[model samples]
Target: MKNKPTIAIVAHDAGGLGGMEIHLNEMIMRLKEDYHVTVVASSLQVTDSEGVTFIKIPVIKRPVPIRLILFAIFASIRLLFVKRDILHTTGAIVFNRADFSTVHFCHSGYLKATGGSRVSSGGSFFRKLNSGLASFIARTMERIVYRPGRTKRLLAVSNRVREEVLADFPYMPEQVGYLPNGVDIHKFKSIDDETKKKLRKQYGIPEEGHFLLFMGGDWPRKGLDLVIEAFNQAAERFPDLYLLVVGKGEREMYQKMVSPSFRERVLFTGKQSEPHHWFGMSDIFVFPSSYETFSLVVHEAAAAGMIVISTKVGGVEDLIANQVNGFILNRDRGEIAAALIDILSDVERYRVFGERARARVEQLTWENMHRILIRHYEENDQRLGQKALS
Candidate 1:
């Protein structure tokens, strides 16, 4: 252990159960064999994880800007004495003093999508004021972290993300490494009829209906509204169709969007803890998100042997084989509805697609992801050492 490389993973919520945090913890677990790992988080819940040192930085968590700035300062200060050969951060906002960072999503790309860009900032006075200020700070921080001669490596989770980062800051293309996200193939297992029936009963999804699933955090950004619109349009033709959305967003907003006759057919599970069970119970997964670095749930759906219908966003192409495994489309309501109709229209096609989806995802595992990450860990550390000596 003493002879092994010391790696420090710094994130705002390393111990949290969100997808990024969970993957971070899993990465820590996997690297423990050849490295001494430590996690620096804002708040941490101690678990039976052997060989991990959790450093919690006390910080308030209301109003995200304050939390980000405070955590960045605290974590930066704390890193001064964190004896480690390499430091990995989940986000660029915090602890810019790092060897490498996992570029999950580019802030500049998100700002462009959300209309928070410097040139085209729009909204009410207060909204614009807040947005402008936040954007300025974030962009400034990003520029500093990604400046030329900085020598910090960037690990992009997907090609789309790498492109996004390079689009924002054109010079860092060579410094960026392409790394994709992975799912636990074993956890996203297909279930039998009995298991599906039990899950449907537990979630109040009618056991007899053909289920359409959508899972994401934000309704607008994740294109939950788009899914609802498509479902509403298609529900009229297929009475057995049921749309089950498991996400964190305005349920009432979407509920009211659905007509009185179709409201009952739409069910919002309100952020499920066990997504595998939801995926197992689902027939088809549909998500038309506006922008994504790499949608992890899409991989989970394919791994669970469900036919996926997503938009042409981010690294979807890496996971989907177009007409073979899943249907990747633009954000057209008619096109989305038509794709759903085609899948439901043909039983044989649906089965083949699901089978192909499962088979395609079989190669995507956490072990593979871990191996790639660890390789980069050593590469980045060695590169930094060479630069220091030069």
Candidate 2:
């Protein structure tokens, strides 16, 4: 006869292509199973919302800093009337005191890492200004929201992110939780040879060659150019090698980085929604991101039974055991090339690497992540009950 506990999730956007959007969508899906979920977002792309209630928050949609400011103001005002047992939000998007907060990226940490430079410092003037302004706004918001007693608990997506949060809010060490992002293991499992060939044929990828995959947007930060250079070096030894690039970036600009003989081998598939298909047809996954809280794509690639070569960024160290399951490299193109050559030159070794990589990430499922989150929620409830009793 008791009513289900209500949970209100607050974000600027509920669903879309980005990592945070996808995380919000997955969390919403899992929360809806038992809780009466309410989503307060500017725009939502989640489809099956039979049990969820959506409260739209008005936003500017341009000059991103303005959009973030407007959303924070309006969402806070909206939250004043919305009743919920738990107030869940992402980062510092709102001013209201929240029961839970998911910190995906630490703006303050990024500024610290980059020597107080904006992410787009090397970009055009307009881009540099916009990124600088956005970083400033986000850092200011974090200062206000991450203070003691403002948020009951903060869930960081990686250990690195957790450290950064503690670095900024040293007083709230016990309040910060480390939960690495999860991947859908079933959706990205190892495929049979027949299935791999079928996927290659379907995607128009050359079936005769060994494929290496580089997936993600923000080409510069993700080190797509470095991958191209590494692939070029690897290709000199193995002409049957090919690189599959999925996601957003200027293709022509990167194509120039490849030698004329190997340019055609570097296939750019543009933006892909279903990355599992590409993962199925690939043999190796290479990602050289300059920085990350957690690179979900690398984990997904490992789950898909691909020999992974990635930099020691984010929680990648948690997934890969260098030269055992996978190789963790520096940002140097030569090192990436050496890893690629080492993997490609050996058949049995690479197979073992892929299997070990898959085994490592198979346990990191979305279901497990949801369970951990639920545990956090129940722990909060227990604390509240004890406080009330006292």
Candidate 3:
């Protein structure tokens, strides 16, 4: 093997749409500096970088049992052709026992964290069936692919995910590593205040309104219903308050769910090209998701000096301190209302929290996350080397 091992980053999802895609893109851009990185992704429209090579493959979009199994079969065959020392699969994919495999947990733990019953069915028969089947297969695959007998490592994005992995698969605790997802803090910080205002005005938002932004695809999981409810109750108190939702998924369904009185107060800017501007325009970031492995939106919100309000899920607790940077509440409507009211009532406190939130996230840049990921690669490389010698 060469001194700098070849690293293959593979995912079964399209690029730049979801949290997994974001993390994969950030990791690929950063890892290109030191390692020979090649990305094998499902159909996506991403352009290739200088040193990174992206190969497109056909795979099923839905996370169904049969589809995932087929994805694994195709990925295993593809891996056989690629020359790499370590094969890291994000999301969920099983690799041959002969290769060094690392699976990063994003949503697998949320099934347990929120308890199975609270998970949203999203009113789709295929989705419901896929969720149940995926849960079962995930449990079974963890045992078969990451067993102590198999030489592979598991990377969890948060300590919570690490706990979930240990609790679900106790034998693999020693094989797991905790690496949180990071944001491009510089991209957010470099934007001037004038640009932020222009972006807000361009989106039809008033200059002085207290904009509350929610950015995510899974509305039910991210607690958009609760956000709308809380905003409805609090809207009468603060007339200047407005809600901007930036993402696409079941928009018509969610729009029907919103009360007529509150409909005008809320705006849905579907799938933004530049999401950072929405973060900049908003005075506070509100995410009330009941289940999350780790929310990149909260990090992005905090990086843009927006007071973050999220539930205690995944690694959210690590990034936020109640009444310090932002607020953390239960799924209760009353609690969410109270927290929103508190932030809306005290502008000075909100400003203070926003500054603190920005300061807290300054250290969580992509560079820092890449450094930690490289450490994991180096550790794995050394262990593989010693095993080869022994």
Candidate 4:
């Protein structure tokens, strides 16, 4: 029998920790069954990788410029020495080192949309210095990683990301492939009304309150401020409204964004391992993120039979059929409150929308995502074998 094709997956982090890290872990776990899997990451804290070989490379934690440059150098050097049929990397300026590279966040697109320069006109000296230094490293890395003939193959997290990568690298329009992030439909299953009632009671949630959900790690980027503002505006119209925010963002910081009248109703569960429970209890899933390559949470919520009210950013339009499954703000902040009011005021409409939302995501399970990924890995394996014979 032919030996299984060797595959190496490189990510900055490992395990089912954080958002992207969890997906990376899942990919490794899924692929290990078909191939000899190895993972090179800066930090790995999970033990679920039984069949996978792991290589740890040291890099200083976040916001440190020297750390990434050192990581890129070390990761490139290591790949050159390792023998593998396919090399998958999360991000870095490793160029041809990684055969398949996943673009989770398009740094160049972000810079282009926000601004080329990171220095603020009236910012403090330290803030300006940090921003300027980080910007320089990021933009430089983007150019190197996305340069023509540098990347062997590019996979985007969303269609919007595919467009952004192609926009940055003009020749890659046809080459870029995108598959939206997948949710485990089984894991995020909807509970019956009785079960939801039990969960609400366990979490000290009022049965009378309409639960609005927000799940994300970054508060600023996820538009949590706007969530608070919109929730406040709708609070008067939709009585007994409660917002349950799950993830890393500080509850204290976000509470300031909420109005005094409804501040106590906002609850933060912090970061959670199984956020699916929260999704099952939510009346609506609201994400007004400023940008996203794709949001796994949005689909998770949908799978739990929850209606989504999100800003039309990134690949949200790919999932939500406005007024059918959910409402899309389409980048208009003003529409957030209006959308919330419409869904809250009409119970039948809300129920129908939630059902459609659930139906829309029923087909996009993690198993399907793994199948697509396996095809990509096998194609690379075949190409590598052919090259060896030649």
Candidate 5:
């Protein structure tokens, strides 16, 4: 292995406070100890403490077919000039390079999967037009980027993501590796009951109230509406039960979902800078998301020793065992409500599950993730070297 491998990471928006940004930032912070990392991003929204160099370039959110072609051309040219051993693109778009091994980290293929919900800055008409245009652009770009005949590795954040990648691009199975996102267990450990009560008081949450915490950005995809419905159904049984949503998204849309009777019980804390504080105050962590590659919030909740209730979707199955560490229910609202009631009714069982969840998540820290990533980097580098000799 090289003493210090030079690595280049590419993402659409590097600074945005989302799952991708969180993953990238954690990886960058850890990888900088062993590798010289450079980040090439479309938009630079956050600053890194590590001395990794960052290059900002224009990225098209809804580029027409012609503009997308130009974007790939310019991106490839820019990438070629950066002398790096590995070209790691954090999303779906592959980078073409014969000399260096390109790694594509699959986030989502929303453009290819669901082409209808594309949003644009130019308003609704432009957004709808952009969706149609995006499909063509994505298809064209994929063709050019993957046509070089060099087998580039693809990293899937979850098994679901790997299946999606295979379904979308059948010819690249050999290049795909499943790497689920991890959480910082040390930072999210359970607080004492006294501390939890203090935090609840600070947040204006009743000390005895059962607070259901939902943490994520895309409220719709995270099934906030379904969560609201389930909470409403369960409210009659447990009057002190409240739903606390912590993340960034359209507030008006979520507001309309809450009935006037339960309006006081629903609290929107917006995007939290440090979410562990809120997690400390929470009674149970609930995630009813319909779509997710890997739900990091579930892991975070587990680490915090909170009773986790999630839909059996995405990478959750890998981490959560029903009635063991956490409860994973079906997508139906009734099933979710039943699970919530069952857990709430049995305090001893809930504590046992929460403790088990914490034990399971204690192994999934950033330190462990860093080691695994480093191994992948070194192994891939050696494989590339062998290919060169062959």
Candidate 6:
């Protein structure tokens, strides 16, 4: 019998929170059965990696600049000596070139979009300095590793991301591939009314209100301010409307954004480990994010049978048909408020929206995504005169 080919995946963190970490975890689980998987990360949350080899990349937790630079140096040094048939990584975390690199977010594109002030815009002097330095390091590394031959293939998380990659590196159109993130359909299952009520009570939320969920960290970037203002406006007409804000952001700062009268109706659950339950507890998912490669929560929301109201960012354009399964609105508060009113006005008729949304994302399972990823790996392998590893 022939030995399985070894595959190396490098990242700062894997099998943990956030979209990119979760994507790596999903790929690791599926790839381990057929290949010898080696995960090079600072921290890992995957416990099922029985046959997988773990290479720990020591890094500091605080001060983003130190952490980023340390990981890049150490991880790159380790990659130089590691033996593997294929190499994969998320973004430009290391100095060494990779066989496959997943572009979760285009920092260079973001800098251009936000005029080189995305992270260092409104923070303290030290915060601004740290973020600015971190951004500089990441951009410099990205520029080096995304050159024409630095990577074999660039797996973009969305069509939006694919465009960003091509815009930044127009020379590598053939090397960039559109590979949107997949949702775990089973984990984010729809809940019945009884189950929803029970969950609301468990979370200390009122059981008798129409819930509007705004999830994700980075309150400003995810448009929580828009969601809060819009919810305030919508709450005026629909008295039963309630808002649920999840993820770890500036809670006190955003709580002030809510109208005084409607403040009591809003609840913030700080940083949930399991967000699938939160999706099941809400009726509508609201996101007015300024930018995203692909918001995994939106797909999870739709999978959990929630009417998704979001801006035209990430995979949303591909997932939503206007006024059909969801509403792709602008970042304006009035537009978001109006869309909320339109959907909540007729709950019974609009209930079909969630059903249709679930149906739309039913086929976008991790297993399906894994198959396509393996096919890509094998195709790239064939081009390099390697045996089929699929």
lDDT string, candidate 6, 1-390, tens digits: 146788899989988888988898898998887788898999888748788899999889879989998998999999898899899888988877778898998889888876667832355889878878888988988888887577878989888888888999745677887677889999998999999999988878888889999888887788888899898889999999999898888788889999999999999889897799899889999999888878899999999999989999888888988788988888899999888888888888888888999999998898998888887787777632243333
For each candidate, what is the lDDT? 0.78, 0.86, 0.74, 0.76, 0.72, 0.86
In the range 323-371, model 1's lDDT, one tens digit per residue, is 8888989888889989988878874667778789889888878899887
On residues 76-180, what C-alpha lDDT tens digit does candidate 4 reach at each position? Answer: 788787788888878644545567778887877877765664323344687567667766786687778765467677888888888888888744565676656
The per-residue C-alpha lDDT of model 6 at residue 319 equals 91
Poorest lDDT segment (10 consecutive residues) of candidate 2: 381-390
Worst 10 residues of 5 by lDDT: 99-108
TM-scores vs. true structure, each candidate: 0.90, 0.95, 0.89, 0.91, 0.84, 0.96
Candidate 4: segments with Cα more than 4 A from true spot? 45-47, 93-96, 115-132, 381-390
Question: For model 3, what is the error of residue 129's alpha carbon versus the real structure, in angstroms, after optimal superposition?
Answer: 2.3
State the TM-score for model 5: 0.84
Candidate 4 minimal-lDDT segment of 10 residues: 114-123
* 1-390 per-residue lDDT for model 5 (tens digits): 355667787766564567667777788877666677787776655556456878766756544554455555666678778888787776434355532222233323554433544323233676557656766666555545543254365566777777766776645665666666778787788998899899888878778778899988767667777788888888878888999999877777778888778988899999888799988888798898766677888888998899988987667887899988888887778888888888778766678788998888777777787676666666677754343234
| Candidate 3 overall lDDT versus native | 0.74
Q: Least accurate stretch of 10 residues (summed lDDT) in model 1?
A: 114-123
- Segments of candidate 2 deviating more than 4 angstroms: 119-122, 383-390
TM-score between model 4 and native:
0.91
- Give one digit per residue, the lDDT tens place, for model 2 in 191-278: 9888898888888777677999999988888899899999999999998999999998777888899999998888888889888899
Report the backbone clash tally of model 3: 0
User: Candidate 4 at 353: error in angstroms?
Assistant: 1.6
